[model samples]
Target chain A: MTPETARRKMTGTWSAHSPLTDVPAAVDTELAAFFRARHADYDDIDPVVADAVGALELFVTGGGKRLRPVFAWAGLRAALEGGGGSLTAPTGPGDVLRAVSSLEFIQACALIHDDIIDQSDTRRGRPTTHRRFSALHSERGWTGDPARYGESQAILVGDLSFSWADDMFADSGVDAAALTRARQPWRKMRTEVIAGQMLDIALENSGSEDPGAALKVDVYKTAAYTVERPLHLGAALGDADARTVSLLRKVGREIGVAFQLEDDHLGVFGDPAVTGKESGDDLRSGKRTWLLMCALDRADRSDPAAASRLRTGIGAVETDAEIDELRQIIVDSGAAEQNSARVRELTSDAVDTLRSCHLASPFVDELVALAEQLTERRS
Target chain B: MTPETARRKMTGTWSAHSPLTDVPAAVDTELAAFFRARHADYDDIDPVVADAVGALELFVTGGGKRLRPVFAWAGLRAALEGGGGSLTAPTGPGDVLRAVSSLEFIQACALIHDDIIDQSDTRRGRPTTHRRFSALHSERGWTGDPARYGESQAILVGDLSFSWADDMFADSGVDAAALTRARQPWRKMRTEVIAGQMLDIALENSGSEDPGAALKVDVYKTAAYTVERPLHLGAALGDADARTVSLLRKVGREIGVAFQLEDDHLGVFGDPAVTGKESGDDLRSGKRTWLLMCALDRADRSDPAAASRLRTGIGAVETDAEIDELRQIIVDSGAAEQNSARVRELTSDAVDTLRSCHLASPFVDELVALAEQLTERRS
Candidate 1:
């Protein structure tokens, strides 16, 4: 079938301001086929390779909100239809789906490596990559240190995922010129995420409590990497003009920050059952989230004793009582209410920017809906 | 200047059977410029990022044989001129230099990550990437474990290098179509090298005594990764035909194995001053090199006592006396002689294959010279 008809059929399921559910489903389908083929290739090389790829496949297709791919899809539609371009000979929806699906591999590489760096034992409630490999080493009664073997294999696996992400994108069957265009943002995204990671460790080690420092981390680690760049990459793929790209980035930045704020809020206040993680873990770890910074700042100005108590509590709180006490202090200092208000304001500003811009229809509407879903969700 | 004229000038310094000194020098120059620009870009982001990139710059430009880039250059030359392609409108020599220089970044990533895996303290007589960062952490009196901080930073730096390698190759100013053509082998090469690394670690941990298994490690770890794929990538970049690419890979695989065998030989016997490392270090570490396998195989067949002695000595030798005795046992068992003979046979066979093939010229001669230098070098 022609690309236009395929696109029409694909979009038929969507209604005004509805979630772009088809994008995530399409991305997952593409990833499944991609991994199956990769599995065969790795098996050809060695069973050891196949094992590594299998772990990566599970981590990639296992669970994700597919946020990056959704944004990329919206950006493409925004450019081809919203940016006043006729839908003449647009890149095929299938090809776009395949290309954006490659983003999941990038996410896989990032999280796998990040877990090793953070010593995070679990992700999405499953054993993190290194931990999984460590368990394998123990189960098989392998020689040498199991932890060392696990970390080493995880490093290689992460490296493999990073390489595969590039290969998958390049071979996503997009036109050569369009692929070249998309490469600009794709390349920048990889570097930014890694650099952001470096910044994170540095911040932790330096004991920097500056909220600005934490926000800078969020801008690079989340705002640009998660939202702005994904949109830019899709826009580039669609051959969108510079103005539209800039506006989308601005909108993306706001939405991304709001999404991150909501996540930080959940890390502190959300239900453990709903989020699938213990709330206050961030407080116990003394992660320099913006929410914590806000709380500290407000309490320091208004009530020095409470601020001191909060400071001592971070990275030291163990019992539920201590965590609850810290949570009360944040709420009493008005930081919790402020954080929620900020999320709402950011979402509103992003929608305002989208509405003011001359960007095309259904995409602008879809992005607004995505923004709400991301920032307003409880868990 | 025009590409043909530039090519003539570049090749003017070469003499038949002489080292391609120009290739390494050219690659280093390109890498120097590349890193300088990347350094600035990172600086623009944040000081922490700038610091990370600085460390990568030092490690990447520090030292190595630049073997991969040289082979890639030879392969490209072979395909363009030796594969009977006319000199008309060849890729600019400068662009080719920049493109091949990207391989050093891959090598950098491999060695940096490998050092972390091996817990190696030094590389090329300098602190390894992780150690360098670890030193910085201690000197700065950073919080948390210095070792963890160092390893985490190194992982990110290695990741950055890997990402930069792709960007450098993609933006090498090569024609878009040729870039697309190069992507196939380039993608495969990345996967193969990482997979090869996985195989290497598995072999070490499995405690397998089979020489065939050792040979399999050499094939993937050394032959395909270090040699065959570099040549294939270069040939693909030059748009060489399938037959020519196949012939080049055959030559590459043979030469690659011989080079690795030479390295193994040097690791055990070459002078520390010459090879810049302690002899028998590999033996002390009990690395499963082909030479070790050969020693075990022959000793097991004829002299069970000698084989047992060798087995017990590995991973346990500490004093100089123990290492000397083990080396003596290897030499007396004739495994050392067998290894040297195999290296010679492999080199001879590779040259013969090149001579028998109907592939293009000057490159054939140049590759033969490279094979001799690689396999016959004392260090």
Candidate 2:
């Protein structure tokens, strides 16, 4: 089928409802197939090796929004249907899907390593990889420190995911020329995200109270990696011109920043049942996030004593009462409300950009819905 | 120049001395050039990131035998001048050099992660990456757990190396078809080494007493990744046929095993001044090396009490007297002698295979000399 006709038919199927509903399953299906092939290849080597791969597979298929892939697909669709360029739709949607699925592996790498750094016990309501392996050591009556063993295994597993992510991207069945084009953004994304992560660690280590520091971390760690680069990659795959890539990047950055701001809000105040994370988990870990910075800023300006209490309680092991007090302090300081206002403004700006861009009407609408969903959702 | 004439000139430069002496400088030069470009690219992003990259540079250039790259270059040389094939000398030696240097980055990744796993304080007479960073945290009086912050930085640094390794390989300026061929061994090497590392961890955790278990670890962890796969990668880059690749693999595997066996002996018995490692480090860490397995086996057959004593002494924070006793037991058990004999035998077999193969004469000679240098070394 012609690119336009195929897209039209697909759009028709989604015309009655939101496109976000189908994305998770589609991305999961692609990842599952990839893991099946990996399992077969590795199983032939040794069951032990297969098990390592299996652990990673479980982590990948377990839970995620699959937002990066969705953004990538929308970017490609926008590039193809927007009409002012010679760039055409990818001949094989399967290849694009596989290529985009690599983003999830990158996420897996980040989360696995992040969990270790945070010393987190659970994620998505399941035992973190290191914790799971640590428990295995204890159950099996293994020697050495179980924590060390678990941490080591998790590190290797994270390394494996990183390697496999690259392999998947390279072997995505895209033509060589297109693959080369996609690599610029891909390489930058990997480097920038890691650098961003390093910056976060550095900020936390230094106990910096600078608000600008947190925003820089957010831009590199969340904004570029989660959205801007993925969209740029997709545009590259579609052979989009510079102007189109620039436009998508602007939209992606605003939405990504808004998404992370909402996350910061949820991290402190959302219900554990809904968010799948314990409320105040980030505060407990003493992450130097934008929300924490904003809270500190406001508290310092209005109530010095409240700011002192917040500082003392932020990075410590806190009881339920202390957590509630800190929450109150943040709320009373007006940081939460201000943060929410920024999210709304950024979401609105992203939607406006999407609407004003020369992208296809259907893609623009879907993107607008996605922005709203991201900014407004509890989780 | 013709392939033969180029081979003649290159061989003449090395006729008076060992090839190993020149390899380190050549590989480092290539690596230095690569890092310079990377620094320029990353420095534009953030000085902090530039500093992180700088740390990796220090780690890479600090000290290493550069064995993998040496083996890769030898394999390429053997392929180019081996009489039976249409394969010629690489038109650009610079490309092969850069490609070979990528092995160093992979080694850096392994070392960084291994330091974290082993909780090692120093390597090659310097503090390990994690320890270095941890010390930095203390010096700076950073908040939170200094150890965690250091470890987190090291993990990201390792990740950066892994990513950069792939980028270097892809951009090595080799023809794309040759690179595609090289990638097969490259991918397998990465996966197998990680699997081998996991096996080592499992064996340590399970407290496996079986000598064969350690040997299996050595084969996968050391032999394949360090030698066989690197040679295969080089041969592939040279477009060598399957028979030549197989020959190199066989030669590499035997020599690689010998290399690790020697390393194990050095870990326990060699003078700290010579080995640059505190003697008994492997024992202290309870690494499941073949030497330890052999010692246990011999001790079990002759003296059960000695075996028991050896078991107790291993994996403990021992006094100097205990370490001395352990050394005596290892020597008295005849395990150390037997292990040395095995190394000699393996090295001989590797040389025999290299001589029998229809490879270039000078390269074969160098390979034989390298095997001797690897196995007969004191450290």
Candidate 3:
């Protein structure tokens, strides 16, 4: 079979209506090749260094939705739809794939650092990097505090991933001119994401009862980073016009926020088996997410005691019963309904924007389908 | 005075013999302008993020030897001397200065993360970034574990510095073509440094009694990162030919290793007034330095009991008396003398290499003087 036909065959086996089609497989293939090359390089370094590289490779390849790269590829395809003959097509598929796949390294950096911040024990049903390294210390009966050793190693590993991201992006085999075009959005994405993460940490500590505050965090930390900026990077690489880039940004922001809202909902309410995360994980961590903020807002209006409980419960060590009670308050206070309504509204807005863009037919259809999958998924 | 004459004047009065002269000030000026711009951007984002940015700015500006940037500038100057007019001069002094100054940010990233791993309380006579952030958590009475919060914030701060380093280096006003030339060494420096850091962490935990292991870590972690790669990067930016770059790399490696050996001596034996660090701090932290390794090896030969004691004492929590005992073993075993001799040999070898390179007169003289200062300094 031809490459395109083989790709279709691989993706076709997924559920009949999946919008991602061959994108996830293609991205994974790119990432796998990238890691294989890196592993070879590290193997020549030393066993210990090689082990650190292996950990990073495992974390990056183990499990992820490949959402950012998917969005980037979709953006590239959408931009190519318009007959702007002035803008040259990307020289080869390999370059575009390499460029987009670099997003996974950025994501790995964020997740590794985030796990440390959240003191998370597991990610994607596996030990977090810090925890894994901590276990290594224990297994070896090494000197010093095992916990500190693990955390330190994880920090270095995360840093290596950050450096590798830039290296891979710059070396992505894209022409120099196209790489230059992609740099601005890449830089912006990095700065904004870190700033957004800082805001998340600060707000979680502040215990502020402001929904807008949480939404701002979502916009900066999630919306721009998870979707909008990646799309912009792809559009830039594709040499899209300013107007098209702006339009893609709008659609991406709406969908990205909607995606995160769904995540918040699932964090507290979704089945552990389905979500692959413990129920109420966010509530336990006291993450200042919009869903929790909406619940607190409703609690203040009608149930001061519930609001007070939430205020005290946040960032506090909580029992299973307390977690359930917090979940109950969110559902009982109409906050859950409000959050769901917002998700629907944002997702619809995103679809409408995409429709108005008059992008190429099948790719636009895929984007709209992807939007629905993002906002309405159970896991 | 004219610009050239003004520069000469600035270099003329520095203790009559200091090799660095005005390079530190020039680098600091470039860094200050960069931070000023970043602080403005962060201030617009949020107060908390602004505070993080302020902390980073203070750390970068606070105090450092500026060795990496100095060496880079010296390399640039030396490369320019070989009138292989094929190699272009930098566009302007501003661009070259900015590019070199970006090295400071990389140093900051390393120090911040190193401080966290070592659980260091102070840096440059101020609370380290993690400690400072921890204090903020406690002062604000924020809920949850304050130490973890502090460490998490510091991790993000370090990551931000890493990102800013790349961003600043890219926007350093260097011509794009020249910047491209520099990217490979820049990338190599990042990867090697982190790999070296990993090796350091691993060896420290392994309880391995191998001096070779410690030296290996020093070569990767300190030597190449602190000197060789920066010199290579500067030479690349100057568009030096392969031979010139390789020659500089050898000089850099020798001097870098010697510099770290001196640092190892200073960490244990230097006066607090001069070093700004408590004596025996390395012993207390159980750092597996070359000095300590030499002491262990000598102890094995002449005093097995002392060797056993040193092994047991290395990673143990130590009181003042215990630290003193550890320090005595290192000195009494003649490890201190051995380490010093190694430093002398390496420094002499480095100077000999520089002598043979036939670099431009004044710049080569400065490099030789710098090598002596690095190896002979008490602090």
Q: Candidate 2 chain A, which ten residues in sequence have the lowest lDDT sum?
A: A12-21
lDDT of 1: 0.83
lDDT of candidate 1 at residue A81, scale 0 to 100: 65
Tell me the deviation in Å of residue B201 in model 3: 1.5
Model 3 global lDDT (CA atoms, 0 to 1): 0.83
DockQ of every predicted complex? 0.83, 0.69, 0.72
Candidate with better lDDT, 1 vs 2: 1
Off-target runs (Cα >4 Å) in candidate 1 are: A1-19, A84-91, B1-19, B86-90
Best by TM-score: 1
> What digit string (tens of lDDT, one per residue) describes model 1 on residues B216-251?
778887888788988888777777778888888988
lDDT by residue (tens digit), candidate 2, A1-379: 3344346445643221225345566677678889998888777665657778888999999967898888877666666767233333343666776788888988899999999998889887799999988998999898779999999999999999998888787777766677777878888889989999998889988888988888988889999998899888888887877889998898888988999999998888889889877778777766677888889989998999999999988878467787788989999999999999999999988888778877778767877888899889988
What lDDT tens digits, residue by residue, belong to model 3 across residues A191-261? 88998998898887766778988998999899999899998998888887788888889989999899999
Q: Which pairs of residues clash in candidate 2, taking residues 3 or more apart in a chain or in different chains?
A: none
Residue A2 in model 2: lDDT? 38
Tens digit of per-residue lDDT, candidate 1, span A119-229 = 989988789989988898889888888888889999999999889888778888778888888888898888988888888888889877788888888888998899999
Show the lowest summed lDDT stretch of 10 residues, model 3 chain A. Answer: A12-21
Ranking by TM-score: 1, 3, 2
